[model samples]
Target chain A: MSIKGTDYYTIDELMAVCMARTIKNGDTIFNGVAVPLPFTAIMLAFKTHAPESIFWSGLLAGLNPDPPFLPPTSGDSVMLHRANPILHLHQIFDLAMRGELDRIFFSGAQIDKYGNLNNTLIGTLDNIKIKLPGGAGSSHIGCFAKNYTIWSIRHDAKVSSKGQRVFTFVESVDFVTTVGRRTSTRNRDELGLMGGGPDCVVTNLCTFDFDPLTDVMRLKTLHPGVTVEEVLENTGFEPVLSDTIVETPPPTKEEIALIREIDPMNTRKVGFSRSALEKRYDF
Target chain B: MGIHSSKDKVCSLSKAVSRIEDGSIIAVGGNLSAREPMAIIREMIRQGKCNMHSIGGAHGVDIDLLCAGGVLRRVQNSYVGFEADFGLAPNYRRMVQQKKVIPKDTDCVAVLMQLRASVYGLPFMPMKLVTGTNILDLHPEYIVMTCPYTGEKLSLLPAVKPDWAIIHAHKSDPKGNIKLHPPYFADLLAIEASQNSIVSVEEIVSEEEMDKIGATVPYYEVTAVVELPFGAHPTSCYPDYTYDRKHLAEYVKLANRGEDVFRKEYLEKYVFGVKSHDEYLELVGGHDALEELTKWNQGTEKWCELLGRNL
Candidate 1:
């Protein structure tokens, strides 16, 4: 295992900077509500590397808003002022339906080896189970965005449960809230979906990408102080490993400054669950 | 002359809600908490309108408040939650999970297309992206048909014409011409698709001001206009004010405790207990807070500097 300045950065900052780098300049992104991490990362991208990136909030359709602080929800109207090229939810969908969206961000309570997401429910529809906030636009965004990013803050037994975790990553999710690339290319063609499926999965501990051939999730990079053994132990399924495993780069001075500038109040700092933040202290 | 017969076009919030029958299917404007017609929603709850249907791609606080008051028999929306970071909407989740309200889990595109079909005066619209998903299974009402031209499989969503569309605006004239700050998320669509539409505005300006602002909704499409300043209340009206996060957080807190607690604390204190939007506004804060809010909305007061420090 390799290490980078161990105590200088938090896992939340690492995840934000790593995810920020994935966003390219001029890329149009559809950011869903209830996603504080990705929303902050997108703002970091805009501030640092991807200044030209257009952020489309599904709630307000405010494109490229200079949000004063990290909003409680993506639907918060505080981001409305100074927004250019404002849109309706339907217009955002119109872009997706027409295959115009370049990237979309989604978060799920559960993700699978194939990157299939579930934010709908934990068990059978009739008898009952833990009911999650229904997939708002994740399904359509999955089918429409050229590529999508799925993330979660919790990466322990609760999120990556061995067998009892029906809501977390599994062999098969209870409901397909967001389709992964595992669906045959021919099937997507038949369904008229243009999306290529999820590009990567960013968790609190590490980053995972899809295998080129099978679309199965493969370990891409481990965060500082995290070992491959730990990732394998935490994940539900056997994730394929990268050819040469590397440490995910910690937040650069510039990234830290920019991320902090975007979130001056440390709203993002408290985004992690108390237990998850406590676990990171060992790192 | 106005676009419609201006025979009593302007009315009180209570009067506007009085027109919405108990079993009516209503399309609500505003996205999430922004531009939500909170005053009208409170009025509806106060009036005890029951068994109503709500339409939207994803409903926010307004619909959630209505659902909390047991005003909905069924909701035909794509999703209902406070968004990712805000967690689940307490009342809506409780109602659906407890089998108190039937949820028609449709897709945002499907809902929009259904409204679009009505706007276009079409019987139904063909969609290519709706195949191969559980949405069809969830919403069996949508008809799947073969495309006539390409011989390809397509989904046909029938027109959804709501009986009344309730919307809020930053400003409007006496004639009901509306001007939003921007991000017209489904508000214009709702106004056009409904058989009748009522508008609640933060302020009423002159017709000339509406013309200069380039009003999005025509007076012809509107059924009535209600002047209710700070109409969105806890939600934002854009250039008027931002959402009162503290107030909403309190609502979420009380609502999450349980249905009984929410009904007692929130419903009793906020909705039914208040006589009018003015009373609700005063009870929530008052003229002093509103003055501070005015400064905040105009960008003169930096929320990031003031609230950011404590947050």
Candidate 2:
């Protein structure tokens, strides 16, 4: 049962898409929090060291990525699992300011033509009215977590640029979370970004990976039945289309069970859409 | 440096806490009993570490010792409940009520901020959440004002970098290399946010042993590594294969009875009597004593479960 590409994807599928892109089995990659994606990336690794594992680092220095390994936000015993912590998150920042983080995924309040994020506030800094989730941690962390950037947009929200969303009566953040190549000003040496702004925008439609230059989110992969045109139509900004757009793999039974049964918090509240799946995806 | 695979480190009950310095920010790692370094934390209590800063996602025994010892200066935690309803964590709740330990009204942002700082190696992080929120203004300790280039007001919240992160884990190698299976305590951020770390382990193998298994946390970052068996006493996870039931019940008894009462009967026995986890076990006196203690702990846990609340 799917609407748009929703019927073809699951929350765990989104989780997996994000995790698979960022974490390697034993890489000591650092992670940030507020959601399970990064934590899942760590836990999913076969070579993770828990009860001592640090998050939000750039490299994967002997990190444990085991199945049963707990997510970082839990407690001490969960995080202490580690291997050779090549460097702490603080040290990793040296890489970040210098542009070293391999993959970054921070939620954005708005996204635009180019993938610049607006996680800080819903409205302008002055005469402020609506405030979405604060960007205290996400703001700086986003600067570092570069490779696999993402913004989890609800299927129902109507906003401006992913970078400039307007969620309230007043002008809130525009719709863009990760700007398309057409939007972002490119500058890595001076801490500027293009496609790195929002490499992937995860929504009900499907996953879109941004081009390094254009910042426009190219259609990386569609869910089992999602169409490129449908995704493009629903998208606020015109997304960059990858040379060979692919289809998202279907969810395995185990993935479904984990999404529904084990995680009660429903952190990723995505379910397959009935209509999206029932209809054709070749738009 | 390493653990003897066969021998459990000094099997016993711990009462007194030692080795904890005053005014240190200590991160307690465990949830209920699954993955906390309970024994070492108890040891810190026996050592009489005062004016302490304690942090945890969900703490059980460690909170008890810190509170009972009257050593808490500040507490940053999500929630604190003994095996049963320990009457709103007297040391914290009472202190908040009586203005002893000031509860810095904050939310989940600080937790993420600390991890972010540690992750990035920044001294303090400039965040966007606490700004314009009560948390920034409410806790004088966390607030700072900044003037943006555009002639606007911005508040800067100093980051939380703990002095030491004390945690107990399932396995580790000689060089303090650790292995966490799953459902671990919140070690990622706790370790990330702290300046230093100490690990008390259930079992320690050789470095080769750790290597054989695979990657583990390097020992260089860990200042102290001890092989303390039953390390997480009063905690329900490893060693003895069961939770300390009666001990938990005792905590609840003291909790329900009130802080003063908790001090007299329960804290006196557990918090004051023994210094080491071993001593606490010895004072447990025998198999029957141990069994009885666990029974009560389990009962208290059930009672708390039945009541179904932290407050």
Candidate 3:
């Protein structure tokens, strides 16, 4: 359980630390609903290096809330505790539309190599297989926020009843709920998207950044025990590998303490599976 | 639009909901699990309103109950499932998978833009985003046109003038003037944009008290108001009460059991089984349950406990 260091941490903690590292010191960050990982990461960033960063609690519509504890649902009014200058839903979207938002985080059911997200449904409109919660503001935020990051708790592929490998990272998403780096044939610039598509995708297993030239997902870092081979096996399409893939930096003791303090109920573990939750790492 | 200057617009929940007809496009206020018009939604189900089109921002049990009750023909909201608290809304997912309710999935900005267009008395509003996403494909009604001022292509979202805007608030007057707490979500916009609006509040204060509170929704926009305390039960009405997590947990459990069981166990037991909101309240542990939800104001520890979070 030890990875090159003495401090023990879980995958969720590492994910939160990695995500927090992406945030800038004064970025006006926002996160969508049901995202405890990002919510924790944002709070971690605020408490640590990004103290000046403006944290807008999505759905709750609170600004820089000093919540006592992380609620299970992001929409919980507890997020408004000590929050200043509460903004309405329209005002939040208006800020994004006016291109004032600095950074936002989103999670999806399906993500393609090009970073297109699908939270709408699994199948076509006519014949649906599974109906997921529709994308709340992903489509607009992905297009308007200055920058956005995609995070997910699920990274591994599943074996369907028919024995097909069902990949969370697919070659093409069934529906594009959020436009990422590019579509199948056109780039975001050509399509007149306002914001930078997707900066990076942080998952349970590894971290990915878009290839600068092609906009395809590129493997940037792997978690403590994950390997390139495992990522390739789980992904439906091949990802551009960096010249040097490094291990994701383990969560510092301070970061771990802050995360625990923010989420004492361990609400962040709700997104992980039972086995994944049991995984531990010695930093 | 005609002005609603009536001195007294107060009515019973049943009488207010009777104005909503089948196949009407409805805009529901409140975001996610907070401040939703739950009592009004229950009344609508009791009245057997069907084939309605629902539009909103983020939502959970409010729309799910409608779908479970077989009340919607089209769902145009941005998001619906119970966020992290539970998971995918069982009844809504089943209904969409079965093609019983057509999913007209929309984005939050697009919805706001369309509603703004309606409020501005315009035919459509143009936007630069949502062009490359499948939302444009899902909504064929959006028109992609080349902007005359600049050569950039823009998507024009048509105005969404709903037949009714249903909302729940903390306080209102008999004349229908209302006051809402912070984080208003799209309630005010929805009220002004819709052709008509009906509100349910925790208390009906005097017109003088409404003036002192400063009305968020003016009397001219609201068609009717009902004093239905705990109207947003199962959903939080901050400063009044938090979401009924234990009750919502039971609802999610029953909803996951399948549509037939939900209809019988949940719909028949809590919704249809009760003749009025008072009866429904009595069934749900009466005053004790409601008092516990309001205990968030007691302290941070009690608030965390209300949210099922232990310090």
Error of 2 at A134 (Å): 19
Which model is ahead, 1 or 2, in terms of DockQ? 1
Q: List clash counts for every candidate, in order.
A: 4, 126, 2
lDDT of each: 0.76, 0.49, 0.87
Please estimate how well model 2 matches the true structure, expressed as its whole-model Cα lDDT. 0.49
A145 in model 3: Cα distance from truth in Å? Answer: 1.8
Model 3 Cα interface RMS deviation (Å): 1.3
Better of 2 and 3 by DockQ: 3
Proportion of true contacts reproduced by candidate 1:
0.52
Per-residue lDDT of candidate 2, residues A93-149 (tens digit): 444444455554554446553445543233333323332323323334443444555
List where candidate 1 sits over 4 angstroms from the true fold: A1-7, A77-82, A159-167, A183-192, A275-283, B1-4, B206-214, B297-301, B305-311
Model 3 lDDT, residue B147, Cα: 88
Q: Write the per-residue lDDT of candidate 1 for residues B1-311, one digit (tens) a residue.
A: 11365634677887889999998888888766677888898999988999998888676788789999888988877667776445677888778878877777666777788899999989888775554455556677787677778776666889988889988887778877777767677788888889988899888888888788888777888888899998888887766676776787788889889989999999999998888788888998899877665555444237654234342
* lDDT of each residue in B265-304, candidate 2, tens digit only: 7667765776556677777555564444234224334323
The TM-score values for the models, in the order shown, are 0.91, 0.46, 0.97
